[model samples]
Target: MNENLFRPQFDALKLSDKLWLMQTLATRYHLTFKELYAFSRWGQSCTTGLFEKGGREFVFVPGNTVILGWEGFVQGMDKANQEELADIFAEIEYEGSVEGFLRQGMTPVRQVTIGPMFVGRKLEEIGWESVPMNDPRITAHPDWLDALRKLADRDGQSLKIHETVRFERNGDSWKAWLCHPMTYPEFQRSLLWDLAASLPTPDEWAYLCGGGCRTLFPWGDGMDYSMHLHHFESPEDEDKPFDMEEPNFFGVSIAYDPYMREVVKAEQFTTCGGDGGRGICGGLGIFLGFLPCSPHCKPKVQEDKELNGDYDFYRPIIRLENHD
Candidate 1:
């Protein structure tokens, strides 16, 4: 049987399509508030104001956009509902604790509450000022936060946004959201492939062989660096852990790998082998030997004009292709 058949026909649809499909589904099946809430993982709204779904839960900050609140779960149905769906006008009631749900390992079947403080400081916390807004690193976090903040600040009151969630004593909720921020404009997401496609391939390759020599920087048009790597080195063992000294390798004690049969001597950088070839081959974990720069492509500006305002978190990098 075609799995898509039992599944909602519009399961693959975007958020916009899901909205219309949900309304149509509700009207067609005549689902009720309680049933819809059960299907959706929404515990309640406005009164006890619990929006519990799956194993997690939330408290709705009333007056926020209705679509943002409920639009995430319309397509994925866990099971078929036999109860007649209720109309919005019909009064329904439920009681659950959003706080309680989150305390457990269970997550709300879907995402709703935006992590407020973490999002507010995403750009400043990271080094956005060092890069351009159009830069991949620059746009990702701010764009995502903007979307979330816009959702929270719909009515534009801090208290109103906070009021949107009140987790019950044993309800599921968002686990620690210290995760990094996200950028948008590529529609769904900017996979690494997208970043690679934007970068123009280098016309030439320069090889490095000297023990303390760095290779020619390789980068082309479009965003050249999608990410960065950090290395730490120490030379002496201290009570704390280790310290950097004359023979200090980058981020580690200079260990001689017998298999490679090479003595990884201390280099100019705090890393082990500083020879040109060793520095250029930088992949994390094997060794924190060198820092390599790659292009990170930024997507075209979004169609939404409202998103064109200045972003405090990112500086936009514009690289003009040389016509010559």
Candidate 2:
């Protein structure tokens, strides 16, 4: 999860290209390495997710922990001139499926990305029918669907006829893309095993899993919930820990891992109704030798300096406005 480890990976890249990639990512995510590590609420961990947006393919095989954030891990991974990195950019250049693209290689990459259109085509091929009502898992929240429905129902809208269909069509593709693996859960489970099997040793999986679990506190409540965005801003009053017998209604819990010098704690802030309940989940953990002077450590602040100028380059491309 250490970003510095990735420096060796990118040794062949021109400095400008490296900086450009860093800036593009920071702009897209609205994240700084410091801010990310100091404020990741999901606990300390590493996980990989793949995405194919519009016609673009990206294999974000992230190895981030609470300490190293996405920016750090990305820079680390890009440090290499490996085929994995080349494959990532090449498929993204052409419209392609992550799994399909990776299969072309002997050692397939860990993640997969089938974008909206591709996923839609698969759904049609499968003959799956739509649910009459929106389910919480399908939508980030009910209101997220409601907002889109309101747009479709606007007066004089060409979408008036079969408005639900319009709402369903536009959003379903993206949801399908996100949940595509869920449809083939067994297949994906096999993938996990394949990933474990391919690792240098099976024991490494246990080490990674143990390291990753320390990074996320499961909100195991059966109810569907969204990760509240307000967790990142200013801190508010800290309350006494909840009583053990009291029902845990809050969405997530704090996770601290001493080995990583990582601390994942939730800081209180307002929630849904502005009714003053606590749900501002913030995660900030420490990494040993984040500062200079420790063995095998260097100041990661250099990447920040390199990224400053190009940080907002992605704004016009796919940046979502006003997410907060």
Candidate 3:
């Protein structure tokens, strides 16, 4: 019985066309009838802010973008929308608690605020620093020390430096090691789950890097070797730290680096990015070394293997509300 006759012609229609079609549908059928039909097609999930289609659950991310699939949320976000979301993130107060780590100096914990279609990067990698015995950030609480000791023991390592503090810092920072891909997920479950924050997925990282760009680097298709900083230059040359480099379209810093960022996919495989050192200017040089820093690049790493090096670091994502 040719059901095609009953189906609405929605394909090939623009957004305006779709709206016009809806208006026509509503007029031909009673408004109530059209409403019922629309609800039957998209209501359940739409009302719940979740859409299940194509075997994937489309979750509503805060701001104008919706996470349609794992590929990249920015694909659904136009430049204006992305900028608007970034503005929202820029205005959001840091409601989360700050954990101060005492090293040579007190390093207050800081996190970059990013929401759907927005982006962020850590000022520096997480590292351990030595602090004075009397540093105010030092906590001698027996329970805290016990917990630290237990964590070290579980890692089969002995705890050193009674006054040691962990922190995220720039300049001479140490790498996070002996941690598997699940490490960040477990940490989120233990600490940040309540805050509605978690480690970023691979897709999130890629989006943060490229936004909608398919370029060799996030900023553009070309990389001027003159802009290369910190790695290849002489000591007398100005030190242009990657973090201080101009931000990408989404205000994310340090899109490419000799160091690798540890990331996870579906909480299963360990992957790394930004490790490829340097390459020629364009996509043609991707195979040389630029591929590691390419937005879509996902260097494979064994899930079970603990990435024990200074190169591996993780970033966190804070989930924002769709409404205030």
Tens-digit lDDT track of model 3 for 1-324:
111111122223344544554454334322221121121110111111222222222222222222211222222433543353345335554332211110111112222223442113342333433454334454544654565556654553333332233422223332221212235445446335433335556556654554434333444333345455434455655555543244443334544554455554455546555552433332223222444665555445554543433455555454433431
Provide the global lDDT of candidate 1 against the true structure.
0.20
Which residues of candidate 1, in runs, are more than 4 Å off? 1-183, 186-214, 217-229, 235-291, 294-315, 318-324
Candidate ranking under TM-score, highest first, comes to 3, 2, 1
Off by over 4 Å in 3: 1-120, 123-185, 190-195, 243-245, 276-287, 307-309, 322-324
Best by lDDT: 3
Q: After superposition, how far is residue 294 of candidate 2 from its true place, in Å?
A: 30
TM-scores for the candidates: 0.14, 0.18, 0.43
Error of 1 at 55 (Å): 41
- Which window of ten consecutive residues has the lowest lDDT sum in model 1? 114-123
lDDT of 2 at 234: 25
Candidate 2: list runs displaced more than 4 Å.
1-14, 17-54, 57-213, 217-324
Candidate 2 lDDT for residue 113: 17
Top model by TM-score, which number? 3
User: What ranking of all candidate models by lDDT puts the best one first?
Assistant: 3, 2, 1
Per-residue lDDT over 183-272 for candidate 1, one digit per residue giving the tens place of the 0 to 100 score: 332311232233111111110000001101111111111111122222332333122332111111111112112011111111110111
Which model is ahead, 2 or 3, in terms of lDDT? 3
State each model's CA lDDT, in order: 0.20, 0.23, 0.38
Residue 99, model 2: lDDT of 29
